[model samples]
Target: MLNEKKEMPLMVRQSLDQTYDVIRKKSIKKKRTFNPQVIIAIAASACLVVGLGLSNDHVMASINKWLGFDDKGVEQAVNNGMLQEDHHSVTDQGVKIAINDHFSDENKLGLSFQLAFDHPSMLKHVENVSLDYRLKNGDGQYIEEFIPDTKPLKGKNRYTSFFDYQNPLIDEKSGMVQFNTLSDSSEGTIPKLKDAVIEIESINIFDNTGKLKKINGHWNLSLSNNKKAEEMIQYKIQNVSSAIQVLKARSTPTALNIVLSLKGIDKERDEKLPSDMVIVDEAGHEYRIKGLRSVSKNNETIISANFPISSYNQHKKLELMIKGIEKIHLIKQ
Candidate 1:
């Protein structure tokens, strides 16, 4: 058993290990160094983390049972101390429901709630978790679909019914119902949030064989809200015309924006965008896509993305990827 001096490193290591697991499970991810901001947050939150006893890690583990299996961005944000703990729980219809964790970053707000039934065998494997929720601010309410933005869902649904198929939801996290709200709206202007509240109306879960179990209850979870780190740059409306992208070369730049057309793509079926995205300039330097932006109009979906470019900027050809398949898109000079 490790002593007090080693527990701080262990906490961060544990968090990073779990994060690596998620990224690995997502096909292929890797580890990254913690930035100074994250280091500061860990130091501040680890005030009483270390102890003389052997059960040092159990204190924080008990608080966050489901934060480990989320997407890379959200997990990093959680490590940066964006998690708002909720200890309150509600029991109804022979089931106990509790919000495990509520995490917010600059772009999105996500929460995980767990459900336990009175009878053990009543529910076995849960395939899909669904719920009705609304986000409210000091002014009023804002209702959104269960559409997720950048952070991917924790695919933890167990598969016992299908004998031939492999279980895909084999995550470290189980029994946690996860949902996120997309805050990326029209350019600029976000409602001033003194405090944020999540009001969940009902909950439902489908078993591996597609059996629906509905539990009706009212649960409210409040969180400490933070303003946008930087003010959004609003774009002016342009006149009716068509636009085409042309490739250019440079040594270094602050950012790069690439747009992809989704002329006839099905949004519902493809709710989550592919995470394996990158851009390789003419100089052979690779830049990963991080800034996610999407716009839908007249049955067309267009993605506008921005990422940091390297110093060797010979922008001739671009390589786009999804599901490990790369498609080279060439721009006109």
Candidate 2:
């Protein structure tokens, strides 16, 4: 019996030994010898059990599903092969904050995180939390022109946030020429920086009665730009016989930004312009506009329109579809 056990392969030896014991008991009751066919049958059954337990898809899918990564944004990133898994955590006052994943592009950055409290009852008191953060280069120069938006996911501890930054000018020379042609005062040029350091000042959370609770911790993070996943397109559209130059249309994993310049249109008329624009991707996914803000650059009226597109990385290209813009009359000063 010892020699037979030694002869068996290592992979199935333990399982075969247990099965052999059961067969030996049955053979002793029947007054028969330990049959070699019984040993072969038990070994084959052990191999089949091991093979099924080690299957890749079944194992990984079960693990991912157990980790609660079924959020739509997380699922999209995972399916598109763009998800970066980082499990960095910081704990303050019994509250643990973790940076689980992130995605970024030239125009926007998105962060997914989990907040676990030492006491589960504390989760019920968290009304809202705000992150105060900024981007800086290796030389520690700050990038000032950007906007951030935060939203909590369906889970009690999961949250996602995005920062919409200024897009790099298509033509640096053209931007300079337009800037100088429109303004008498001098302003600093916008610097193009990638893979910068993100400095987080503090996280403030409000309670049920509007009591402000501040979590003070300094967290520095560095992220690479997802240029391959981001798409920027330029288009010239004719509205009411006037040309509306879509200077840049940028799509990132978390947001879409469209820069529109209405040439020869009065500022007052541009102020009244509606930002009812929609984006359609190659996969037939539609995104609604979230915000529209006007920034003054010399005499050029640049309208920055932003849309929440959490699954933008899933598509290769997108189209800017606008309705009710052709009816607006542009006034020339």
| Residue-by-residue lDDT tens digits, candidate 2, 1-333 | 000010111111123234333333332332222223111111110101111121222332232321121123324444565545555666666655555555443443345434445554543433334445555655556643121233111122111121111111011111110000000000112233455555665654544354555666666656454345443332333343354566555444434446676555465565344434556655677655423445556666666654544433544455555464432221111
Point to the candidate with the largest TM-score.
Answer: 2
lDDT of 1 at 66: 27
lDDT of each: 0.38, 0.38
Candidate 1 residue-wise lDDT, 285-309, digit = tens: 6655323445567766665544343
- List candidate 1 segments past 4 Å from native: 1-71, 143-193, 226-302, 306-333
Query: Per-residue error at 45 for model 2, in Å?
Result: 54
lDDT of 2: 0.38
**Residue 57 deviation, candidate 2, in Å?**
21
Worst 10 residues of 2 by lDDT: 177-186
